[model samples]
Target: MLDGTLDGRAWRLNDRYRHHAASEVLRRAVGDPDLGRVALVSSFGAESVVLLHMVSVVAPGLPVLFIDTQMLFAETLDYQRAVTARLGLTDVRVIRAGADRIAARDPDGSLHRVDPDACCDLRKTVPLEQALAGFDAWITGRKRFQGGQRATLDFFEPEPPTRLRVNPLAHWRPQDVQDYMIENNLPRHPLIAKGYPSIGCAPCTSAVAPGEDPRAGRWRGRDKTECGIHFIGGRMSRRKVTA
Candidate 1:
């Protein structure tokens, strides 16, 4: 199904990935004599703070791309600013869907209802692709647990056309991420306690049932859980839709 995996052909990376190895992975990728510019992407979601904090530590000034789909929940937006400020992260850049494009296509921002994929292409994917094009490698916070299509995830992937992808948290368990967040005192998305375990665009996210998978609330009952932004890169890649 997936291609451009590292040494192994399968989706999983070897155990040699090391514990809490994201920092090392980042250092290697960002420091690569071959690769050029490097950047990190964030959604400022439930578990997004962990990676963002880690990025602040590894590369404080690295360009941090935040795609403001303009359809995100209020909680997510607030969390974005809070976390950026709390962590003292610099180089935070926000990407938004072009107003002209939105006015031309949706005109009312309801396009997400009729065609979710294309909505993501315009709101999330296309803009991110444009922003990421300036970099040689990008880092993401994807893990293996967010199942649907991500039962297995890799640490490094090949970005088509050019560039490479780095998954710093591919092996981290959900609890590990939670612990990291708690330990760091990072701001949590306001919607987390509202049962929207996974935050996305306001309209598509909902509350999940007890024992339900973390991502179950997103696009519930529609089989359209992914938002498309993460597909082309990492966290948003398999979980979200994108072309």
Candidate 2:
């Protein structure tokens, strides 16, 4: 059971520990106005098919936001197109960093090397915040096993002050992801077979060494990890949630 505290208070998951039942969460969220405005953000990365497929099954027309960092691999672009069509996902929108922001803040494109946090704010966070302006909550594919800041993920918790974040696969193992893919005959990201177990922007990701953390390849050799696209709160400060 998820009995841990969140922000010095108990976290609730719709009155139960929602370690399974993606369909239940999907249906419930979709049936309510505040929650139904929710959208699924996908990277079309190594293991995104699980959640993407789940969302498709529950609501094929539900909006799915895909952040095209413009620095991603060609394979990922193709994969995104192919997967959406195959799953009959009717509402997949491609979002990107505002071109003006990129030109003004990161003209040379090496901002990530010198200041990853700021780069992420401009490239990933700001646009995502704008894209999600009207949402009450959002669904994430995060799992506890990713083992960083996610060790205590719950089924339903406050993203902060405004949104009720939902994570249906919080307790799933890597094997669970595999089982879902195999059971459903889902298409795999081509880069996964090329040793990029986790995918992100091309410049930040590389093939990992044997036994390295699955996310190690991302932002390799840098003091950074997440691109901050799915950050819990404010685009610039990470201090407030806008839902």
Candidate 3:
């Protein structure tokens, strides 16, 4: 029963939920009858457990989408599996790039070296777009303190022509996330202790040093900040960029 212009509904929803607690925001989004089917698009990276844990408490059976990208660190894959089990999250769906697409577009797997953007499109963007086709809305873990393009994020945003994005942790500070994890006794991503404050695909992801922006390690030596998955009107938006 979700009806109305994308912007209209998105703005209205934002106004309604902007001041709600993170847990309440999530509960409303997942339980909204008008939202149709909503899925959580998670990378299972650093701090991802916060939202995953919240969803488990609100609705453990809710569909959780994880994009593998075929180039993730072994630790990330392991963390994904462990988080799901520890949180009792059901319906954890793994989305990946098709073999045919990989063979045709990146047979040698050097596309990441030549054109990281296209590589991201094939690996993350396209796969996520396909997986999200049937859902009216999706949840993300983006936060405002991540800096760059994420500094202005809101709890709800209209996804252009159609669809809506819900960011329950949009206003959470870095300490807030850490405290939530500690308070809930959530398991941390294995890479965090290894100086990898921000984690992504293996080749494009590097470890950051102390006193560095958490995202400084990702796409290092390149100007790219995002993987092209979070986008608006053909331009990429923000993903995880916090420490």
- Give per-model TM-scores: 0.85, 0.88, 0.94
Q: Kindly give the stretch of ten consecutive residues in candidate 3 with the minimal lDDT sum.
A: 234-243
lDDT of 1 by residue, 1-243 (tens): 544443332123333344537667776667764446889888888888877887788788989999998998887888889889988898999999778989998898788788887788788887888888678768887778776555567776655546666787887788888887788787778888888878888887888889998888877778676776556544445321242
Tens-place lDDT digits, model 3, residues 96-191 = 988999999999989999999989988888888888888899999999999877899888888755788999999999999999999999998989
Model 3 misplaced stretches (Cα beyond 4 Å):
1-3, 234-243
lDDT score of residue 52 within candidate 3: 97
- Ranking, TM-score, top scorer first: 3, 2, 1
Model 1: runs farther than 4 Å from truth? 1-20, 232-243
lDDT of each: 0.75, 0.78, 0.88
Greater-TM-score candidate between 1 and 2: 2
* Candidate 1 lDDT score relative to the true structure: 0.75
Ranking by lDDT: 3, 2, 1
How much is 52 displaced in model 3, in angstroms? Answer: 0.4
lDDT of 2 by residue, 157-180 (tens): 675555656777877798999999
Model 2 TM-score, all chains together: 0.88
Pairs clashing in candidate 3?
none
Candidate 3 contains a number of clashing pairs equal to 0
lDDT of 3 at 218: 93
